[model samples]
Target: MRRTTTGPRDLPPLGVQQAFRLPETADVVLPEGLRVVCLRSPSAPMIELVLRIPFLCATENDGATAEVLATTLLRGALGRGEEDVDTELARAGCSLGAVRRSDRIEISGSGPSAALETLVGVLADVLTGASHAGTEVDRARRRLAERLPLLRARPSTLAAEALRVHCRGDSPALRLIPAEAAVASVTADGVRALHRAAVVPAGAQLVLVGDLDPERTVALLAARLREWRSRRPVGTVVPRAPEHWQRPVRLVDRPGSVQSLIRLVSPAPARTDPRFAALSLANVVFGGSFSSRLLSNVRERGGYAYWAGSRFDDILEAMVIAVNADTATDTTVSAVAEIRAELRSMATKPVTDDELRVAGNYLLGASALAMSSQVGLATAVSTTIGFGLPPQWLESFSDEVRSVTGRQVRELAEEMFASATFTGVVLGDARLLAGPLGEHLDMVLA
Candidate 1:
């Protein structure tokens, strides 16, 4: 666990006078090179461990590695069979989790103090033994075969994939990895090779929080990982994908659909940009929530769709604004027009002080609202470390957000949204969308 000495750089502005403030945690360094920021609180009977590895899609230039590595981790490991891991975990009533984000793979879950050993052992095996058995590969293939066709039926899911394809450019984010083609193409040796280099003990972190004795937790992790070993992650830069990954419009052509699927996207500000705070708040006013401009214009006022919202894909390198909805095919063009108008209004106009406060409060409030659990806090810390934001970033985030003025929000908005690199994807009857939508957008009619 890391020592909790606050550096001068770690001071946060005395922002919110409300909320249960998170404690200052120590940055824990392990025997190999694993780094973890741990916060130990013996306030409960269970301990939550969130392990964050720095190697991610950004590092490899291909986003699929993290997903592939995570999925392949269950076959066997460190002399313990897959059944042994499940039996041990069931005996202890413990849970394991794995998430792949832009910059890291976050492993998190919890169990009682008495169950910690079993949890540790299971993780050790998972990190060391993941075999790509032919049977397991076939099982994964069968699962994907069942799930892939279903994904094509959902608009929201398709739009998200489209956003990834647009933002990341021809990567597996849109296609899903290891592609059915790639997965079918996966060999035992290939999986073994990928695991040997990427799944090193040193390449992973084990974070212990809540009711954990720092000393004991450290000891357990050390013993469990003693033989896990470490290997330096391979580092090589991948050329940047093009800004416009696919064409502007990709009509998936789902005929006779009750609602037309609308996907509107364009790259936006990154999380680390100086104007990030403003962009964030600006986004709130744009489409971060139900109170956003898009919702107000496209839904409430224009009555375009059943639902609508925009999300920021901010992480290691890039970020984007994505909007989706299910509406009538005839309203598709009008909804897209309203969305652009809202984007332009945000960019060209200034927000009100009242608007700024509302956005700030919502953003900050939302953070504390969701993190009311130990698991949530663990996820927050993992992302914070993965993003490499300043130590006081969260502590000071409220103030930065509140301090943002209307002018700043408008300025940031204009800078980020000027190009209008809009992508309009309608995943319904392609014949219905034959009109002016493409003239204003980089349109690809499927």
Candidate 2:
């Protein structure tokens, strides 16, 4: 097949088209109370497995223990050592990892469709018979200790950590990096206890997407995962994020830094709310994309920063809108002022028809792109399951984006962004930033 040699200008004009079709989905609840979500993508030759366990740590120490457990769970299981497990998975063309998040622990893996049974068996073994060896636990703990300091050295990471602490207020959920002392104190027994308490089948979701029969897959999963059970009762309800957004500006003093990292955070609407579409569109207009007002004003026109953008997190109880920028220390105040002004403008003025159309097209195009891959589809399904949304929501998303009007965008802006309560953080050299930042914000050293 000869490839087309058309230049960019010689190609046909770009236009929006309905390009995505929702995959066939089935939701099943096993007798052991494990929820299974299956999506069949016959065109893909690979199968993806995503398991979401509702794992919550009650304290910072517990959070440390959970992190250690997540790292060491796959090291050995069912009479196999770490290298043995790796060799088996490699032979089956599979890979596995587990990540501990604020609300849950996600274990994800993928392999050839023909090896689905093998993948499931391996997953079951790890879940039920993981050997939390003392040596492996100690190694994981040492690795974490070595990584924490390097992560803290980055200005952006420092800014995010400060903001999370400001907003969440010492909650274990916000403890992304446990203290070195806490990690050092973690033991193999503690890791085992955490695994037993948090890695249960109850309130867990197993999502499978690829070329397979949903019914057959469900039956196989039921049989394979039957032995994995927990006597401890797990709560299905997701906890609410803090509602308080009002706070004085926090300055994490990263001395000798030439650039300042600015982070602005506020609360927004949840994904299930009727206003979510409107907020999403409004965000695209504000700072969610390259053509957004924030980028246009701060980076493009003023030439104040290298990049500026905003993002929205759709959690269970609440949503979060965050704007991030890295600018020279001298221009930090100006960049911040421009961001605030654009936010205020979005809330007060009505968006133009062209802006609305473009933002809607961007959202739809991005969604279509995301669903074009097996991993992407699996992730989308997992997110929907986490939000407690129906399967049809993914199918109807494009229509919902198309239905958002300028008036709805403006209204959502007014409600969510007009009186936006901002908790801002700046990580930079104190000597360079203290004067300008202090003029506009109540600077506090962190």
Candidate 3:
């Protein structure tokens, strides 16, 4: 028999991982100020398109108009009825959608590579001449009004809206859920006016990825969107979660609720910041993953919550990290306390060497998996580009995570994850949880 020792065996050292590289992209700017980025990936014979326009709402009513505009944009355009648009897209085997957010309006499309020109032409027509018909506008308005109550009733939605209100005050851009009256007031004329003012090609980004010639694709877009122009500059800088305007912990009362939704928000470094990688890994160890300390303490050990986690929320040039937990009504305060304890521990102590290595490996692996698909890669590139970072950021992110030291993570955690740095909202039966939570947090009723 082979000799065996009682001493612990040392595992082999990890080998160096290959660097992640995205396909090379060709970029161009149209005379109308539209930026086009195209990459050739032959994984499939289909193309994905993402168009981003800086559409800002000046008030809640403007948000209503934007919502209606997005709904009706693909409904009809250029003398084409809704059915006509659909038929044309179906002929090209294409699918498209338009979404309006507080910061921007996004139009995404996918189709076979052979139909790229036709797909882009349809989108261009919609962009330049969307017919926000009265009937469609009314239908969309009714749908939104009907759905608003259901969405607002969700505890998670309640907590998120409360957090936004507390962090950003009453900024209309951050008002994701509009009031019923606002939705009822949306009209075709209002949507058309908002589209005219906001949906110009100036300062917009269009990313196309698939099995196509990048140069030819750029040329095609430049020619097709030549008329999709306006003198208006981009509007609405994405709203940042203000670090200075934070309020005391808010308790949104939900009578007779069985569970409490807790959300804590704190400022986080933007992706372009050098500290971003360190903070991301630290977050993974702290609460970003299933194996995070927050979950282990608050759920597995204390039995106060079913789930708890954290994530980075993006804004214009900044970011915020949110810690979330849902727990039994009676354990609400205990869960919150455990979350705070994890934060304190992360802030005060250096993560172990093993924790740092695991977090780094997880971060790198997750990034690769997220970008493995053509759609995922396109989205990653477009999002990074939209945030004013070079596409190379995605390529270098793995290396950055690999190089992050335990000390760096600890320092970043200290800088960002302190218990005192957070402002939050708790949605629970205030009659049952208010007294207990108030003692541990600076609590207020909402």
Candidate 3 Cα RMSD after full superposition onto the native fold (Å): 3.7
TM-score of 2: 0.92
lDDT for residue 88 in candidate 3, whole number 0-100: 89
Each model's C-alpha lDDT?
0.66, 0.82, 0.85
Candidate 2 regions off by >4 Å?
Answer: 1-11, 233-244, 314-317, 442-445
Considering lDDT, where higher is better, how would the candidates rank from best to worst? 3, 2, 1
lDDT of 1 at 220: 69
97-177 per-residue lDDT for model 1 (tens digits): 666654456677788877878887887777766666656655655665566567666676766555555445553333433
- Looking at candidate 3, the ten consecutive residues that score lowest on lDDT are 232-241
- Across residues 1-446, which tens digit of lDDT does each residue of candidate 2 receive? 99876777565766856846677777898877789988899777899989998765566687788888889989999889999888889999998999888678889999999999989988999999999899999999988888888877767666766777666665666666787778888999989877877788887899999998888999999999988987674333334567566767788788888899988777876777777888888889888889998899999999988899999863335568888899998888898788878878876677888999888888888888887888988898888887888667887766777777888888888777753487768888888887777777656767
Cα lDDT tens digits, model 3, 108-214, are 98999989888999999999999999999999999888889898888877777777767776677777788788888888898888888889888899999999899
Tell me how candidate 3 scores on lDDT: 0.85
Clashes of each: 7, 0, 0
**Where is the poorest 10-residue window by lDDT in model 1?**
56-65
